[model samples]
Target: MTSVVTAGGVSVTMRGPVVDEAEAVLDRLVTDGVPASLMAKNAQLWGPEAVEEASRRLGWLDLPETSRPLLPELAALVERVRADGLDRVVLAGMGGSSLAPEVITRTAGAELTVLDTTDPQQVASVVADRLERTVVVVSSKSGGTIETDSHRRVFEQAFRDAGITGEDLARRFVVVTDPGSPLEKTAREAGYTVVLADPDVGGRYSALTAFGLVPSALAGVDVARLLDEAAALVPALHQPYDNPGLALGAALGASALGGRDKLVIADHGSGITGFGDWAEQLIAESTGKEGKGILPVVVEGPDAPGFAEAEDVRRVLLGARPEDSGLGVSGPLGAQFLLWEYATAVAGRVLGINPFDQPNVQESKDNTAALLRGAAEGEAPTVVAGEPALVVGAVEVHAPAELLRGATDLTGVLEAVVAAIPEHGYLAVMAYLDRFADAGAERLRPLLAQATERLRKTPAAVTFGWGPRFLHSTGQYHKGGPRNGVFLQITGESAQDVPVPGKPYTLRSLQLAQAFGDLRALRSRGRPAVRLHLRDRAAGVEQLLSALA
Candidate 1:
């Protein structure tokens, strides 16, 4: 039987054998006062003081209550932007720094574009037309994120190209970062407006703070109302079974423990589609470490194209009501943000893991840095030419026979890879092609469906995302989380390439480097991963679809 819980205009429908256990866990959490303790800064429940030191960064727990008071200041900033006629915003960030703002802009109709990807074409596509009126928001918690820094550098040059320099350029820029961080120092020196984020809040949890709200305010969203609605969930945090956050978190942890580890979040007309991206980073980074984690698969709808079908998947439906229009958008989204944050913390407790730390996410970053520094010394990706296609890396060849054996074409390689996933494992289909290649990516859905049917024998999950983008988002969870993933990296030759302003490499080169770097990082960790490169986007997707058929 399916169980449904509705709160604050948001509904969570959970179905699985672990539903009861999740409820029990929620009850225990309430009885133990876990949520309240966390809010009270009780770090002992998480783990040793050292192991869970990050847990003390719980200022986000009070953001809704605390940030409500800042609405006037935020509104003033927004008014200034409007008065200055700044019509567009280009947010330069990565992961936690970017996802929440992206959601706010999407749901609130903010005239803002998030530049979280380092792909040159993506960067060009964003700033090409709006360079004159766009205000660049350089957001980063550490202030030294490689991708954010790269984006800032590129856009700074773009601003200069548009003849906006010195005080003018500073007027067109804002910096959201912690006090004394490199970005704050740089922004102060450059005369950019600096919004200091609460140092006690981690990046993934900073949604209610300036990292998320400033952009929301700039986008014309009602920050005061959003905070007020978000604050409503505060009282429920102390409750046990009736609390939405505790219930949802227990379900997530219990489901994973029961073998349904894939959390497929289905957003059905919720106006919060971008919430999935934010939730993905929150859940993945917080709990995906210490060789255990829950996989979050955010889909548009249950019927979304290329949606994963597997027994290990537990669907979480985010449904919207007809009355939920305009400012009402904040109600559901704000509640969800708080719900998931609380639930992730509870789930971490259930899993006996520290919810605040991300230990494995740095491996890929380190590897990418090594590759960029030319310090990555290893064998190049092995290549094999076949009919109308070429296989790069040993991903498919190294896959289980059930997944790849008896294959007659390039599609068979994908078939085999999907078939190789264990009952408790998952398939991460990462595409490094253009974001516009949605139709091409959709062609592989039938294959995923077929793989899902096969997965019933053992049960697994499938996830798909565009590259470099996912690198900043799910990339952390994939590398740092549990070792239950079988990775399939897809790449195609770019039709055209754009170069970074002062970098030696083109966007295409950088994309490939990131791909290769991630592959090396995965293999270095002894995880199963493979790669397939197509000659060009069109022909590659077409051939692969044909081969699958």
Candidate 2:
């Protein structure tokens, strides 16, 4: 742990064993061409105030009082959902409102889905079908999210179409927002029950509040379990080396001085999907200024999988650490963030960019909009197909015997295929090999060095989480970056179809499988790539890695 004086004259220490010598590493990073201005900006973002605010906000005291009057009422609502035979809960909102529920669902492995996009088909499907059986949790701190309102309008129509009207909407729909926000007013006027989000708490930080809790509870997740997990982190905050979150913020802030442009947050599970959005808002809104910001890139692996091969793309920062005894203190979500904070700071300092900004994010949006505009007029983006370039390596085919045995089921079969790949010792990717995170650069650092040593040039290392979300955030980069990576695409076929009870949506397993296929199709064109299909998915992780060899 290193101690530094904040600009406020207060001494704050990041509590963790340093990955490398901080100042020496920082010096070496700058010598490599990191801008000094970025360093100065990060120094300010990680100064006393920012760190203090983060600690407090992430700590126990920042959460609502445990005994608030609404606790039991909230609990009752959740219990009711479970008893009513609902199988999935859908949340509608974008950014902060969307990310919190995502984290909670992931941490608890809840059967809740969050939709933040304005896709009409997606909205129509969920509202037209699921809303009748599954509850809808609409979260908007400002109560004026155009997307949220749009979803609500669609949901209301669905309710009416189902012969469920008026007061019944209050039972099936819930709203989380500040008092008098347009959402609040709409909810009250529309006869929907309201759960107030803390006015003082910003949207990005309201996951632990009503924004995250209501949906989490409805999904049968234990919200209190999450709080207890967070509370357990209190003692660690005061001791510098013991605190993961603070250490992360500091190291990442310090890394921004070094020139690391990407902080990839790699994870799996639908519940955690919102994490990317949360990180997106947090880093983009907080650390973007003074011309230096670290792009918070998030990627996921084989629950969804694809790796990018773009030269202009930046480093990969793996967020998960090996599970430790201390982790028992916090819930999985808390542990995920605590570990991520440390990695984020480390990547920021090494990269010399503030981890709080969205640098390359705009390029994708602009490009996509332009492509859409052209397409609207019956003009499609031009694609010039060249020779098939086998980039990553040849796609290995298991013996007929092995493939047949593996084909009994998707999970197991996929595991066997991946386990065949020899583990690359020097490059440490996320536990799941195929996904990328904002912090993934740290994992790829050694591989990068090795590649640079052999090829005399660096390849862009890009990552995306779940297949659908990546198509939104980094699709443009993958399509446009100078193709130079061995894209590693990983996905699994379903073993048993877990039907959505009475709903026509066969099972989430199929939807996810199809999404992965769509992602693969996007990457296979003009690039040398290999796709491995795992029909049996229950295979163990070690077995999967062995197959990858």
Candidate 3:
């Protein structure tokens, strides 16, 4: 792990399976970009002593009696779903509301297919297929979550198409939302059961609450065990020096305030990817504002994309403090973890914003709606296949040492990637672009800076599609981007594969590539313009990537 002390006097350590690389990346970031103002803000929000004080008072791992009431409710709901004979559960929401449970499920080793995408075909497929054996759980704190509502409509229509409308729709579905929101009314009107999301609990913070519990119950995950695990950390989580979560949270927040605004959560194995995604949505939605935000990044496994050479870009996963270094307990049970959330919550309170209400978050829904509308009207276009595969030109590939030298400039590196893989119609590199490390900064800085320079040098719209969880969120954007998004889709052969039971999709190369192909079609002029391929892993797996770059 490499550690950097922020101007606020908070030290952040970026830990990952690849300690040497991660350390180097952190050192580079601390030296190159963190600003004083941000550090100061972080200092106010996550100072060590303050964090310690907060932990001691909150009893790091202690759950208030008020919060305790939720466990039974959640457990009961699980029994209800199971008793009702539902085998699948679809969580209908975006960002924080959706990510955390999926994370816990994967981490705890539970099997439940989570649908967080808005693609019509994907949505229809999940519903039509899963509805027979599963129960769709529509979750949103605000009943008005446009995306959730859209999903509800899809579900309703699916039921209607199956001639299972009216009471049947209600029986097949349940809702986890605000008690008095429009969603509750809709769920009730449609005849489905409802579970209220506490008004006091924000989406990100609600994970320990029903946000995680409800889905957990449906999946037959041991909610009690997970909670007990969380409960054990209560005291330590609240103590600054002793609480790993608080320590981690403060350090990470301080780092962001210091100018390391991009966070990358690299999962060495199965559980971490979902956790990374969960953390990404939490920080992105909470801390992103007022001329500042921490961009959270998630890398599922070693073979996952985003690993570029040393000179190009490197990935880092922010983790809990020293003492909390055990597998499940390590990442979430430290002072840094608590402090980061506290700092984010405090910042929101200072901003007079309801961190709980993600209002403009609905813009994504509007975009999707507009795209679908356009597609239907023939004004918005459908992704077509591109021409026969084109052969890419070869480029001189540099050694990893040389690559590290150019690590700070991502645009040049990406251009090299494009040149190497020129034959592929679309090229998306999985290089680390998280803001938490110098490597990430270096990785993305060049591309953005180059784009700026290019715009200055010329007037073209330097088009780029950059996102951490773009697989779900920006597929529409990439597939829908002006037929110009070079889709450099990345996938890796998983060390472990979980087949969808009886379903033909085996989570293997064919299905994974098929998913990539769905994204590729967006670049088609009715031709095969998209290229899909795989790597052994994110690190040494650049064998194919280097061949193209």
Using lDDT as the measure, which candidate wins? 1
Per-residue accuracy of model 3 over 335-433 as CA lDDT, tens digit each: 223334544444433333333333333443444444444444554222322231322222212223332234333334444434332221223333212
Looking at model 2, which ten-residue stretch has the lowest summed lDDT?
A: 322-331
Q: TM-score of predicted model 1? A: 0.88
Worst 10 residues of 3 by lDDT: 432-441
Listed per candidate, the RMSD to the true structure in angstroms reads: 4.7, 11.8, 12.5
Q: What is the Cα-based TM-score of model 2?
A: 0.54
lDDT of 3: 0.44
Residues 119-231, model 1: lDDT tens digits: 55566778786677787888999998877777777778877877888888888888899999998998999888888888888888888899988877877777676677778
Candidate order, lDDT descending: 1, 2, 3
Name model 3 segments beyond 4 Å from true.
1-67, 163-166, 269-273, 300-549
Once model 2 is optimally superposed onto the true structure by TM-score, how far is the C-alpha of residue 245 displaced, in angstroms? 2.1
Maximum-TM-score candidate: 1
Candidate 3 RMSD computed on C-alpha atoms after optimal superposition onto the true structure: 12.5
lDDT of each: 0.71, 0.46, 0.44
Tens digits of lDDT, candidate 2, 469-494: 44333333344332322333443433
Which lDDT value does model 3 have at 24? 38
